[model samples]
Target: MGKLTATSAKALTAPGRYSDGDGLELLIGRTGAKSWVVRVQKDGKRRDIGAGSFKKVSLAEARVKAVKIRSQIEAGIDPVAERRKARGIPSFREAAALVHAEQKKGWKNGKHTDQWINTLTAYAFPAFGDVSVAGIDAAAVRDVLAAIWLTKPETARRLRQRIRTVIDWSVGKGYREASLAWPVIDKALPKQRAKVKPHPSLPYSELLGFLFKLREKETMGRLALEALILTACRSAEVRGALWPEIDLEAKLWRIPAGRMKGGVDHTIPLCDASVAHFERMKAHKRENNDLVFPGTSKGKSLSDMTLTKLIRDMHAADLKAGGPGFMDPVQNKIATAHGFRSTFADWINEQTSFPREIREAALAHVNQNKVEAAYSRTAYLDKRRPMMEAWAAYCGGSTGGNVVQLVNKSA
Candidate 1:
């Protein structure tokens, strides 16, 4: 039987803990504030659970609530644990932090880890950070990603991936029953059209003239940019080149797996022009760093912006002279140092009889087909050597204007 009647619970004014019966109590404060609580014992330990305020929960209602809690205790379940589980559903922001903490160790570098969370913090947190992870649905995720889907497709794509990762982590931790966000959220986003502005690339016909002007400038920036074009390697790969990576006798530049984009070792056969250019750069090598293209400051690789700024300055100069300086015809933009890789690819496809696989291997592009990747162990260095040599001759004014159309009759 309960201790307090509805009439008595409201009439009491003193500040004290008073019991109703069957563990139900009326808690009164010194200021005469009133609330209901229930006391229960399980495993020789007593605990008090809040029922509600006396003003809102009547004695009859308190008894009903107490009865349910007692029933839970009798069934060997901790009511406190159940209550916490009910109240402690994680927010999206909290889950993201947990996911980051757990997964940061596996990431390649600190910058990548920061990028993973920074995107979520900037875009998704404001919209649904405080919302319960379990409560987050397709519409909520769509709302966050759709806003930037069109304007920042790259950012949106990364954000969507990180969000899905966080939600999947939540499900794995038993925080949510299912990850209802991904695949479905992908469909909700506006169909992103393929990007129109490819990296600006100079046409093969213009590359020789561009190389002449490029060679006129004598700086590490000029040499690095030239190496990038000649090898068709990524900026990082070219900028971070080490003295040990280059074997002048072998006429090869072997980039290790860690620095390469594909996470596989790549070998670039140095053309005569490219080899000579590297020899020139070797004279300017700093004592503190082995980078083939060291930054203006000692012991640092050339900044990515270094090459970009050089290209822009060249474009400005050409524009002043009323000449189109290494312009990408398709986009009407100044050709970038990175764009030279595409120029190389175009030269291969349009001018040479090299198989696409050989050309792609020269560019260090990974074969997407798993079986092909597994069986295609050879790098075909012997075949790529002649093509690179011809490319160098073309760049050095030894050839021009569809000079040698080595058409593959088999192809």
Candidate 2:
């Protein structure tokens, strides 16, 4: 065809699409809405670029716009993206929210979804939120991430990843070209010390003493720490624990997949010591809330730093008494509550004869081998009980009398 005539274009009352050659078409909506679109192949992928509606742009005007778009495509430029740039695309925060909304379904839960958006708001947005996603470069990303790189490495790492995701999404949406920022930012950041890096874990020999010191102070954070150490669960799982997830009759703490790091529901076979600790917490439980260890703010869970501060205060107290305090032997750093998981794992590896898989399962670690994971459906709850009991005994100290008996389960 030699292109569409204005009379023919106006006369066409077709309910479907009518081509005007050179990859241009007039689309008639089911509701009788008439619009123009161009189908162009770029980088071997066909993309439809929308032109103005037929009511607004005449057939001649549509042809003019389509010809310009085709020229841009021939020059290896994406006209749709250029138009978005001309119109001033969304800022980083706006784009991040779009990306966040798009990726929410794949995330483990709503809390993670909130964290994803909140972290960007708190850290990334303050610096680049107002800037267009297309305008963000490696220097901006590095500056933002480097501020917390050494101070808060974990948060900084997550922020970097999220920022990259937003930028990549913007490119996919044709808001920008493929970003050069990713490779540049990756290379610009400082390398973490791989040699000395390990979660600061107290030596197993000192764990008993640490527990004794922890027991001397009575607080919800202290109890939460105890629960974490005894059950070998994550701080989040321990802090977010609700009464519904616990079964005193069965001595199990069933952590839903939403709270677990592995995105799988985990069942912790509670040892006697952990059960006793929970019973103590129940006496002080807020009647209105379900949290096992609710914070000072009614229904809210304890902050992550609450547990950290408890450990730090204990270490300072020990030092005032002229002791080395609870220090990680390898890194010479003060032990963190998280490091207790490592301590638990070490104790299992060194002090017991349990198979590696059972220990891994207790820690809620997903198997690296996909095939084995697919076939291994068991939680090994039975095998883990004795091991946890043994751990509880060790944390209770060898002296035995120091282990606080919070409840009389037999009664």
Candidate 3:
């Protein structure tokens, strides 16, 4: 029998180590916290390995573990390595990384790939990042969400989904028990007061003057920004523009599935104004470089900050001249590059007679309504042509007055 009994192990509360014989020892911390430890010798090296807490792991349980450790050592196994390898549970943070690395390649949006992990890192990591995934109960999950559930409803909802995704991934790996108790946790979390925040957008009425100002000092950055506005495409789409994608003859810019935000092929109709920007870029195209708007780096495109800084400078200049400086009239915030898409959308809804399908096509927005998306297979390249030309016309001084004249290819 071991030197210490269950009653004796609990009674020894003083700060000291007491041997239970056969390598097993009871350790009492300075704070009187008691735990079990056992020493083992293998390969001429001896080390102490923890069995568990004295209170939770009774004297009998500690003796049993000590016997198992000795048996493993006798069998020429590194008990330390075996114990580490058999770490009872994986952490939530570790599970998230495994899930991200495995699934990120399928996500087409570059921003989305980063945001997937970023949200977890920002919120979930603080609460139970290092805690064992298997140990996480509904209370822990509820506490992680309670702080933001009511204040930032949409973000919290997305965070909840992402948390559940990691938990579900852990469950598949056998790191968690059953599925997450989200249904039970949901009742504990406060009901979110849904608040939707849209991108700050310049008013459509002020777009004409904004476009005119944008064209005043013509640089590669301005040209790129104009292309983004005229085409109503996203920032990365315009910045990463390739020469081969542009077709002056067909009046189309074909963006392949890999390059598009949605993993679907998109075709953009080049209006009279958009073609002019491409024509200007044609003169500056380096023999080795294929980027339509190449940055200072040999083959690299301009950074997003380059365009952002350009807008900021223009805003400062506009404010200096006693104007609103391209402010989003509603939010009273400066207009953003992405906000130009919102501006395009607002103008299309208010001023234009173009059908909803055609407008969505112009912006390359995937319809959330599955039924509508099923019926709207046609890209309406022909219809968007006139609509874009008119948008260009409206963006210009009047009806197509400021647009660059079409160059005759016959020459």
Candidate 4:
């Protein structure tokens, strides 16, 4: 027969604890609201369970709740856990949003965030977006990825990784406690090993012929192609090259962090031939655009696929004319646009006695060892100066002398 008075409710607060008759406690809050709770001793150990609010739940109703909580104690069941189980499960979208927000800060760029959402929307959301997070299992994830496993193996892998990340986040945030092991449960969608396809490249003998033909058919596109071969740089790197990035007087091209694959600034030592080519390009430059090789339109750089398409057309024409087309030595098939890099690598290995490390550095490959790479930070621009000069001579069939040192006037 415990009564909670308005005065007592007003005095009680979050920091204070009080008890009513029959071992049931009436915790009065600072807002003058009261909550009924029951405290019991089971096996000489004290345990507490919240009964209900004083207004919504009458004193009699709270007594019933307290009695039910006592019964649960008698059965060795936690009443708090039972209340949680009674609540409706959260939808998958709700849990996923929580996970996404938690890990958004760790992402490096907006692109990474877009990828996260795109993967979920394309795979996870269609199946489980409306379903409860607690209801999702390993099988649901497996079905989504397995649908695209053979047709789109790389994309499937990304989807699996994204889903695993979301599930891991959900587990950490106490959303769902299911120990469902995704991607592994269905071994059919095992991570596919990336096959290293050789870059399409023309042999040294055919390379001169190819360049000669390109010179005869000299368009803006052909000039750009010549620049790509002479520099031995990636198509994107060459196409995206701005006039501002090139230092003609210094014979240097500085590729900024955003343009480079490793997200680090790189400096390329331009040979006399490359500088001459840039000088030629200056005569045809657009008034408003600063692009070293601007598109036929204006402002926009050449499309990434343009070079590849050009190479394909060149290969077809060569084949039709009974000339040696862009053929893979190993596969006996037409070489790809990207294969030029492999051709360059092969030529470097066979014709020159240059160190493999120097060639690799020229190709802008990242060194694996942190310590060794740090010590070798000069990028060997001086060493590569000769190599690049030799490469240009090899490509141009020029009987030029070896690279000479150009002393910096400031130095």
Could you tell me the lDDT of residue 251 within candidate 3? Answer: 82
lDDT string for model 4 (232-283, tens) is: 7888888889989999999999999899888778889999888888887776
lDDT of 2 by residue, 1-411 (tens): 437788888888868989999989998866677889888997798867777778989888888899999999999887756865787788888999889887776544455578888889999999979777766767878999888877787687668767877887888887765554454565677866565366888867688889888877567788788888888888999999999999988999899999888899999998887877777777767788999888887668989999898899899999999988998743457999999999998777656667889999889999989999999999999998898888888787222233354332110
How many steric overlaps are in each model, in order? 2, 0, 0, 4
TM-score of decoy 4? 0.49
Q: Per-residue lDDT of 1-411 in model 1, one digit per residue for the tens?
A: 566777777789999998878888898866687878788898898777777777788788888999999999999976655754687867889989988998776543456678888999999999988767765768878988899989998688668767887887888877765666355566777877776345888877788777777766456677778788878899899989999999888899999999999999999888777777677666766786788877766687888888888888877887788877767754457888788988888777656667888899998999999999899999999999988997776677222222122122100
Stretches of candidate 4 exceeding 4 Å from the true structure? 1-193, 397-411
Error of 2 at 132 (Å): 66
In terms of lDDT, the poorest run of 10 residues in model 2 is 402-411
The candidate that wins on lDDT is 2
Cα lDDT, model 4, residue 228 = 81
Estimate the overall C-alpha local distance difference test score of candidate 1: 0.78
Clashing pairs in 4: 199-339, 200-339, 200-340, 201-339
lDDT string for model 3 (1-411, tens) is 778887787888889999999999998976688878888888898767778877689888889999998998889975655753587566778878989898776554466678889989999999988766665667777888888988877678668877877887888887653565565677787755435566677877788788778877656777788888989998889889898988988889999888888878899999987887677667767778889877877788878887888888888998899987988643446888899999988677655667878998988888899998888799999999998998888787222234343232100
lDDT of 3 at 275: 81
lDDT of each: 0.78, 0.81, 0.79, 0.71
Cα RMSD (angstroms) for every candidate in the order listed:
21.5, 20.5, 20.1, 22.4
